[model samples]
Target: MAVPSARLALLLCLMIPATVASSRSLRKSPANASRPTTFFEVDRPLRRSSGRCSTLLLSASFGSTFNKPPATNAYSPPRCLVKAGGRASAISLAVLEWRAACRGAQLDRVFGVWLGGAELLRGSTAAPPPNGIIWSVSKDVTKYASLLAAAGKPTFTVYLGNLVNTTLTGVYHANVTLHLYLRRTPPTKPPPATAPADLVVPVSRALPLDGGLWFPIQSAADVASKSVALPSNAYRAVLELYVSFHQDDELWYKNQPGYQNGPFREVTARVDGVLAGSVCPFPVIYPGGIYPLLWRPIAPIGSFNLPTYDIELTPFLGKLLDGKAHELAFAVTNAVGVWYVGANLHLWLDPGGTATTAGLVSYVAPAAKTTSSKSADPVDTHYHATANRLVSATGWVKSSYGNITTNSTRTFALVYLLTFETLDLTIVADTGVVATDGAGGVMYSAQTHGNFPLGWVYQQNSLTVTHGLEETTVAAGRWSSAPPYRSLRTTQSSLVEDEEGGGKSWGVRQTYRYNATDGCYFRNVTSSNYSVVSDHSNELCVKGAASVGVGAVTAALPTVNLP
Candidate 1:
């Protein structure tokens, strides 16, 4: 029997006409009100010229890798680590530059990289155009310097859940490179400029596959946990978690009562057997979400670099630092379908002392207050709901540094308004959240806010819906500060989708800005029918761009205590 060639089996043919190319390097825009749009994402750029660097990581292509084992490689320090003077070259920083391209009909897939049993990064691929599309992402991994230079040779693993078949054929080609920056002259400071944790502990399983280490949460009872014998001198702790929803829970916020677990979901974490913190995860729209035409050269918010939640666990250290093994657990409330989750524990050890004594002074954690009411009228179905959660812990720790008292709080509220079986709406804001406070002053503080308002207008004939239109506005931001490390990132998108014309004729206008103590970035772009309409980007960062959107910032909601 002769098997059909994959290219012969054509899926939905997406005619992606190249307007120019997705780049600012090809056509530079003048600093004026009028601009020529380009295809690009609003990602922060790193100064590659800061020092001497080299690519010493893996570079390969992946296809038909679904359900099979992930690609693994043996890793060792590059030859550049040694100098001509017969001495070890001092490594100062690490950065990962990722580039990928794909064409033809295919679905969006998730990808990740792990080193020495710890995940370095996790992200999703973009839906490609017929003429092909290429995108790049740069991440600063300076904090993981110790792990990258650990003992002997460890395994480097790459996992991308992609499937190639006779019906859908799109082979993904990617280049994963690690650039190591060397230090000049000599070392002066006690700690590096990055101020990373003393040690990073992976809160994941040993399996290294697509969803290997990640726990699947389908219900409230399905909690993921691990036991660890942590360092006794650990004075500060934080959890950096990665999350992605699939199946029916993909658009969890838009779901309603009597259908797929309602419209509310909460993520919680604990130490030993005590509740530590909770949060309402962000509704990140993938590239192929809702309508694929809406995202072409530019993807939805946080697609390439998925946002990770940081939960301040310093107050709970009074229970964990007893120098014994303790259990760390994670769970989701009112979950449905599948939610893949995993985390890494970043611990800051007391530099002056080997051991520390700590005690919990006060703790307060209450159940979530929730309410919802649904009713149907002659023309439309009405639905409204709200959720609130609050948690706080205070403790005192005595070490060689001093007697430091720390308090952490987490609070968030959510309100939803919807009508018709074709539903929409969700909002979350920060009222007065003081994430972490020390004896001297506030060590770290962050107000995480999000408002994803959507509109659905369905056109039906008789008992069948003919076509529908979707308009979405995303107004979100994160304002955080830790002395010289203060920074703010925000963005807003105006999107419209037309299911007519065989699912064509779509457009989007977006604005993004990032400002911190170190750098600045600004971008505003427009797209129509999978092509660039207008684009203007600059290194000069601005403000108030993200505040312009369809909905107003709602009341406060439960937030993760960031330390």
Candidate 2:
């Protein structure tokens, strides 16, 4: 069953462990001193770790494990080394820094990092050239203090499945370090700025942590889920999901499924048996997509650090707070082996309440509706498709603070039109999509506005994921293309994240052109062999649409984004 929501296509984005017996051994690739480390990814700004601090080497020489499939390396998170009435209690913040390098020559590989049982990072290794390539990434981990502060020493692990045969000899190496910033004064309640969720529950397969907890979905019928028992005092919840498409679903843009025009895919989340929400993922082009050479120094945008999506589940907390295990499941309908999906639930507890009373007011969500059309010529074929979905839910909870009501509304509008030139073996995929998500009656008011593929906007007003879920109120949509090309392709892209006084918005503005001698792609549209692509933002930008109307379709990029 296909999911009913269409939200992600250009900016949807993680990974989780395993133990398998295999003799396949890989020699580590030697680092090249001459090759300059190039390539970077987009991420939320990093916070300076000041005050008494602690650091731990999370993963070392990961290249050795890359060749080991379903096998993961594990380390227990040590108590913040600095002693001050107990380091965990004095801890004020945490951050993760990673460095990787590769030499010789090899295909790019995908990897993930897990802290405790929650997924922390999802990335693709840049394919190294003969000499080699190197890169680094830094992330803020203050949001996961609960996991790090656990006294049991939750396990930290990584899963990087790779290949190293005679034909592909490049080996990738990575080292990760965790930094803990602590307070110097007497132990105090964490400052509001450093406060995170009270609890974080991993929605993943139970332990063994083998190969690392990430489950795989071979097809649309395969739904990956977990059952969790919540605290009666929990008043709010937010589900953060990470997704990556491999195999048949990787190039979903060009997929010709059943009688559907273009391609269709959506991610859906369910609570207990009732559907909660869904989204259309952003078509992130990996570094190896469409002639990998083009991304030698600068990888495709969002390829290195795939962005994660947030689904507000506070409305469903009404039935969940009754105190029994509830099923939290995810499904990628229209997928083909395998789409990897993982998630973490951030929960907020009433400061002084032992239990809360709640009830679901109303709910409405239907299967997505889609239509298609096709035109055929003696040597060419063209396909056009349109999709729309809307979901609205309302609920209320009574806590020590009294009764509070929360309501939510989400909408997705998209149109995909493509052309297949058989003689030239060329394919053109253009996407014009817009989505809006919102939640009300929470501690903070937040919103996200924009479209997908080329440019979009995401803004959050609260630092605590459990209380303030971003309500994306998009007034416009975006358009991007991936068409087969010949030679000489130039791509540009840039991302901006700005914040002030607790109001945060990830202003993602990117634009690029892929022109080849073959005249196979348009100046405004992209040129690819199926995968999605993007470029720097300051250089160019297609006039984006202010809003996506129902059943709206446009033939050109200029029309997709209106002034």
Candidate 3:
């Protein structure tokens, strides 16, 4: 549908319209009823010159430039203007100059190339410094659209590309910056008066990298993990890069325009869409100006601690999205220190409808651990012991953010630590079918819940989730200080839960089975079966690893204390 032009001027201007092709195009404005009354001496196309700058001034005109406005509310224009399948006309590189005396004009065309994809810098570089090329073709036109009673119409979308690619490394100790601005035509008459106050859209929180958890160490270790959830809808993840860095503050960069303030956050991309970084503040170094560094990536772990931080990108996978099967690969710095890096397109979700999922990547202890040696000339000790018990754990928790009504899908990762000196660890879970009597009373499973599904167990330090069977065990001795380094591998298994016979009359409604040797075990379960014929019956199991120590420094000993 073609967007009308009449609604160009918004009531309380919040966002600038990228373009207004139709006479009734709807610009995001406040709900104040006002009309244009005065007529200005439409001056000759305003001529602006600043050396050989490539910025162009296009002609402005009135009357439906593309199509007519809607009849229902004669002023309402179409939501979109470009033909459903036609691409916008290509912008000319020549001296583009045009002028039209009118209320406003829709930006028909715009083209810009960053010196190094910088956002702030503009113009072409030859011998004269401030070298760069920027081309803009715009016309001030008006259009309008009817507002639905409940749902606000979606305005145009802004896609930021050509980012400076600064890697934000380290934990709470470095700074990052971003820049943003709206290109506008100097109004002929004084701009309209402002209302008492302006309504601003709250800035989105800075999303963390890899679901907010990075594991650079080869051995088993955990980091603090958290997530911000959104309702169930599509969104765009915006990233900001700064020009200067601040040594004192951990999250803020030196004063920079058009970027987000710190406190890193989770950025969401629109469902079934691709996000590419845009370059702002270009021309970091004039006359081939050096691109200012915006964000930096710093590794908090000591050089000897963990080789490379293992970032978890799993949480962002298969978010509420529909698309052909695709892999999500993150672009990260292979180097250890801070530097400028690029983020390439990784995954593409097609237009199919699928529920997006999110969960924890792993539980990490904030402070590092220290092992104390027993004796200076410690005697080599070796002992083997075995024991077993039942164990049960909850499925990964799903995360989300924003108002539930907005329908935004937030994703998170699930992770855990695994260590083995001489002993082993095992986990069991059951997959059971849920049964309900079409009312809001009791719920029962047809079979016992035991042995988590196959892909459920995260082996090799990486946690991947897939739909299917359940139950898995951590592999033994996958940890070495480096390579196989020190890690855990797990085997997963699953079973169906048997159901109870109608209301109260029941024997073993669900049966869980397990077999193990020499491993800590715990089980905590809470289940309820409510039937109209009887009061709700509840089954609760609370268990934990009975004897903690499985791996001791010199020999396998449960003598070591655990937190």
Candidate 4:
């Protein structure tokens, strides 16, 4: 069954315990941390605390639990630390446990957290586990510490929704704990002389559809600030985009054999109508007992966390920081269904700094595009399908600050190949009957089924400029499912290099391969000293090699107005 409305019921609860219990064992913590931390716990059933630091819990229940029909719930913390003034040292969001109810199966849910209407984090619920042990997931939210602390009566919301329909009724439990650590002494280097201002725009509530399927959704907003003129004398600027997708169980056209539905979807961001960067969405899967064991060892135990996509829009700051209203828009590509999105522009201004003189020099739209072809047998019986998709973009920026003038360009390209053949078959059965004193009978039946052989290959190459330097990254992945399409095997690899703007450069390359049969296993290889292979028994094994004087740096570099 497929869910028609595709909405889930969310229950918000606020919990404040006098003594917080630490679930640190469930996740790994970053090094270099002090003691004395504050914890806020959010769980099922609404609870209020007289304590100053309160916790909010978001829980989702479906089907039978909605005795009175479900509605959205909003919560606000009594006080936020960021508003207290001193700079924040660290912040993290730790998910203690996310487990599905006993009766629920075929689960597909999306979880999201928002502060003051701005999205902070979002992810998908993991498929139910066979053993029933709950799993934990964590993320570093240090970058958004300021936003969380400064929120005064801000709207904090958690949303949960189903992507597909299921027959069972159950509750989806989520426990999220927030950890905040503030600096007691301010003896270190003083915080930046000035902080960045946020300019936000509300995009579409639902992602738009294209070509009968959900294509990429795009929205643009004009930049404005109530406190100050837009982008006036800025040293640096960055744009943050919070994107969420509402996917259905029928992500791919099941009727179309050999076509992948969601695994390879990609999203890209742009500012001032110029290309910034692109990212591939991680596929979320909920496996049943019949699913291959190989994935069990390598996959996330009981949770599928959605990742927040962040792209550096600093390169376009030259044009954006002109002290004038500018348009900022984000575009998502290769997506299937409705998705939500929001944008925030952060600008760091220099004290006693001159207005920005950098501007767009020449721009070339990405040659990125997708094409497909299909062939039929001479007998007009069966058909074969093939598709080629190219993802590419290029941009040029030139800045004249003081007396130095530098020009730079960023280019990226990704190629995807898909090929598959569909099997054709026909069957007939007898079914008909009758009988009486001395009579007879008859019967008839007909049936048909098809099997598809499917394969997919993808490669990505990108060049980016950071702190006046150029960095290039390349990644590739390939996978194929055997005929009848019951399982999958995949191989993926990536390489990253930093150009020193000199004759020599350093980089690392890694490759991974996974097999479904033989109880699930993996082999991994890493680049090292031109030759030495390291062997291990891990699910993914690694081998190493290195290279010197491979090539010269060719990416153009840019000069900026700020340090």
TM, every model: 0.79, 0.69, 0.18, 0.49
lDDT, residue 400, candidate 3: 29
> For every candidate structure, what is the RMSD over all alpha carbons to the true structure, in angstroms?
9.1, 15.4, 31.1, 23.1
lDDT of 2 by residue, 27-57 (tens): 2223245764455543333454366354555
lDDT (Cα, tens digit) per residue for candidate 3, span 7-115:
1122012111110111121112221123321111111121223212232111222223112211111111122211111111111111222221212211111111111
Q: Give the top-scoring candidate (lDDT).
A: 1
Please, what are the lDDT tens digits per residue for candidate 1 over residues 1-563? 00012211211133111111121112222212233222345666665466555764777677888766777788776565544221222556678777887766677777777777667787778876555567777777766655666647778777787888986688878888888776665343323112566677888766555544566787767988889877888776777787878777877776665556777888888887788878777667677765565466577776676667677777677788867889989898888758878888887677677887777776777789989887656455577778888777767767765666665666667777665423445545332223233445533333434444443332221001011112222312121212232234444333332233443344455665655444566677766555666878787744543343333222333333323
Number of the top TM-score candidate: 1
* Superposed Cα RMSD, model 3: 31.1
Candidate 1 ranges with C-alpha deviation above 4 Å? 1-40, 77-93, 181-194, 208-211, 421-424, 429-503, 541-563
**Candidate 3: which stretches are off by over 4 Å?**
1-82, 85-228, 231-354, 360-563
Model 4 lDDT tens row, 201-298: 22322212111111224221222111123555653344455545544322222113333332233455555454555543322232221121112212
**Cα-lDDT of candidate 4:** 0.32
Give the clashing pairs for model 1: 37-534, 37-535, 411-557, 411-558, 412-557, 412-558, 413-557, 413-558
Q: Arrange candidates, best lDDT first.
A: 1, 2, 4, 3
Candidate 2 has its poorest 10 consecutive residues by lDDT at 14-23
220, model 1: CA deviation in Å? 2.6
